[model samples]
Target: MKKKSVGIIAEYNPFHNGHLYQIEESVKATGAEVVIAAMSGNFVQRGVPAIADKWQRAEAAVRSGVDIVIEIPTVFACNSAHNFAEAGVEILENLGADFISFGSESGNIEELKGIARVIEENSEYIENFISKKTKDGWSYPRARRAAVESITGASAASLLDSPNNILAIEYIGKISNALPVTIMRTGPGYNEFETTEKFASATAIRSLINENEDISHFMPEEAKNIFLKSEPVDKDVYFRLICHKVLSADSTDMEKAPAGGEGLANKLKASIRMCSNLEELSESLKSKRYTRTRIDRFICQTLLGIDREKKTDNYIRVLGLSSNGREYIREVKKSETCRLPIITNINKDIKNFKGIGYGISVDILAADIYNIAAGKDLYRFSEYLRRPFCE
Candidate 1:
């Protein structure tokens, strides 16, 4: 009999104790022998730069119990939640994963499933609920929750409001349209900043790290070590890039930027002159239909110069996988179902793979430019630091 495999999509930013708990619980709950993790590279899905390099984070996942680690192509890694979830689901489906394990605020699989069912069915109650809420000028998420509550009662509304729960629903949305992978969720809100005995949000940890404050109370010992060893690029570096793009590019050109649409380019063109930072630029662009996160993703797309229509999963870039991960790859090599090639080295030429080549090149260029802007040699350092799964 073949060994069962589960997939996890993560940023691991530092891979703290909370992450470890999720890994352990995933294995216990799914009873899978192998776990394939699709993680972000130097940048995360949230459009923020990661503190640690990708290889180190992958190594940490392997040490913690993951069997395989694949890179979530940079194009998807630094986009909106919907795109992020779509890219992850695409990789898991191609990998022939049996299940996807994630951490959610609700933690109650039944409640998440209930929400997923409503989304999948697109019931009249949900539709009317969404329409009414949108007419009132509420954001889609807030409105959707209100709609769910109107039909399913307050409990459902409360569950959908949690940040992690929203992500869980998105994950389900992607999975429903893409693959047959089962979902196993564990844990509390990803936005919770306060430290609990077992749960702490990545946002809080990142904020503490950014402020140079004590994070020992929130992270696992291994994660703490990794975080200390890593040096993250300053946020101001990205801010300046955004400003440059806004100042130099014409309104028409800004419209060409990823996710820039519907008079947003002109708005950004005008707003850039008025706003001093990325946060403010995002705020200035936001409206009833466009949320802060959506605006952030657009800015990130402009920074990376990714063409939204061209996004696709063409190859599997290996960040760092353990010996076990390598063995799994070797086993899957014989299966025709696994169509995408595993990229072991960055220098190798893969001309035939259009999407993969574009994704990798874009990421390398972004890292290179970001480093130059910051007066650091991140590209050169990344080449030396990056290692293969078995290495």
Candidate 2:
């Protein structure tokens, strides 16, 4: 029996066949007895509510062969890629994972690691290079890629061309200890969507679902069932709510948000006055200094009341786990595998807490907002009332 555990971090926006492939490959590659997943709660790194809630996604992961599934926290889940990777790394480290695996466009784990090392070693030089590039009208990501090319080579910069490849570098860069594994990405590109393809991108799968197309090929049965039944978040309603929040907030309130600062706040207020939807709002505010994804991050942070100096709650919120996962947790608790308090039920420890100082509280707030978007109030689906799903 393999003694080691492997960790995978993902949004699993709706766990699909690609996710299942990663789960099996991670085990085969690492010979890991347990596969622990650090998942985004209600919101994803792309600054949007998950197609299904966190519980549904976690349960899907467990059914698809992940042993233990934990929340990656709202503060990290809905932020930029760097923050997302850093938070995921920290949680897996806490879980005592011996290996980490991720899907990447480049499919070269060693090359990515080499690039990560070069970036880490020349952090100061990179920062200066990025500043120069950005000043000359480049986006932060573009600037960073060019800066890396200046140090390593063109191939190293090419690694950042795709979304998954960018995430791979971040995952490897943040690794202080765990062994890294890379699975070559197959099928359409991360942004490309083809519902007819066997390995459709999650983006395509989501679009197919949105169009009410049968996605049985892309998703597992359990995930497909959940996706079909779960109340999808009403983006229109949520966008209206955000517009109201932006239109009503004064300069002082916007300044306090600190996500976009005073200038971003002004732009947000101006954008909401004209735009009726999230897409329009983003387009209205998009500029040389900010990419669409950057705008989305700022808007999400602003809407969620996240401040500049984000605080961490330092708690492990277990969404769900399988029988093997439970056994694995028991082992971790017996030893020093995980250093943080493992929270299984929010109703007990997290629900009634009046203070917002708890790190998990942010996740709770995000869930409640999702509840609102999902047309639930005082519903059992609230994260507060959720008990760990054990299979």
Candidate 3:
């Protein structure tokens, strides 16, 4: 019998205790023998560099508990929640996953499904409402929440207030081939910087890392050792690069950015001149209509030269694998359910990505740039030189 495989969409920025809990709980809940994680590479959805690069993070995840870790290409991984969730679901489905799991503030899967259904049913109305509200100087999240409230009532709309709940709704909305599983998120909130007895938010862990504080208690021993040996990518390291991109970019060039258009390019150009640092620059661009995350994403997209139109077909690019993961891949590849080409090796399997080169190119570029940001020389074709981490 084929073992049940469950999929997780994660950005294990440092593979903290919370993530470890999620993996264990997800496996317990689903009875899934093989766990696959589609993790963000180099940069996360929040539009900042990860604490460590993709390989280190993936290795930590595999060593901790996850059976397999695959890279979520930079284009979708660093974009909006919808894009992130949709791409993750697609990749997991392509990998022949029987279930998709995630951490959420509300672990009630039925409630989440209800909310997703309502949102899908009212998408057009919500979009129109969002358009009207944005014109009235409201942020996208606030507008969308209000729109949802108008249709589903305040009780249901309030669910979207939590970050994990928001993602839960997106994951539920996007899943077609796999079942949805939600593990109740414990400890501090998503962006919370507080440390609890057993769990700490990734935000808190990253802050601790940035401050050179001990995070030994917050992460698994293997994950901690991996993180301890590596230098975390400092967000400020890319500030100068961002400034250069913004200053040197023409109106056309700015419009090419993933977050560009609607005069935002001009706003970024103007803000870059007066701001002394990345935080100040982001603050200067912040408004009711544009959240800090949106601004940060724009800055990252600009820094990496990722454009709005550079979409690519989805492909599963494995970053790390455990023994069970290798066996699972071997079995899954022989089955008709595996819909996408799985590239375990970049050097020899680069040909499998012929038509889907755009996403891979973006990932390579992001990694090379991340190397520079991490104070490493740009090893030409680093993507090709690196191999997937195997247990």
Top lDDT: which candidate number?
3
Supply the TM-score for candidate 2. 0.94
The residue ranges of model 3 lying beyond 4 angstroms of the native Cα positions read none
In candidate 3, where is summed lDDT lowest over 10 consecutive residues?
A: 231-240
Question: How does residue 56 of candidate 2 score in lDDT?
Answer: 85
Segments in model 1 whose C-alpha atoms lie over 4 Å from true places:
123-138, 146-154, 176-188, 197-199, 256-258, 373-375, 382-385, 389-391
lDDT per prediction? 0.72, 0.81, 0.88
Worst 10 residues of 2 by lDDT: 350-359
Which numbered prediction scores highest in TM-score against the true structure?
A: 3
Q: Report lDDT (Cα) of residue 5, candidate 3.
A: 90
Candidate no. 1 TM-score: 0.86
lDDT tens digits, residues 1-391, model 2?
Answer: 2248999998888888888888888889989999999998888887778899888888888888888899887887777788789888888877788999999988888888887888889999999999888778788888998888888788667877888988998899888889999998777878887644567888998898899988888888887887788787898988977877787767556655434652778888777878878988999888877788878877776677776564665567888898888887887877865766677866676654433354676777788888888897747767767887798
TM-score list, all predictions: 0.86, 0.94, 0.97
Please give the clash total of every predicted structure, in order. Answer: 1, 1, 0
Residue 329 error for model 1, in Å? Answer: 1.0
- How many residue pairs in model 2 have overlapping backbones? 1
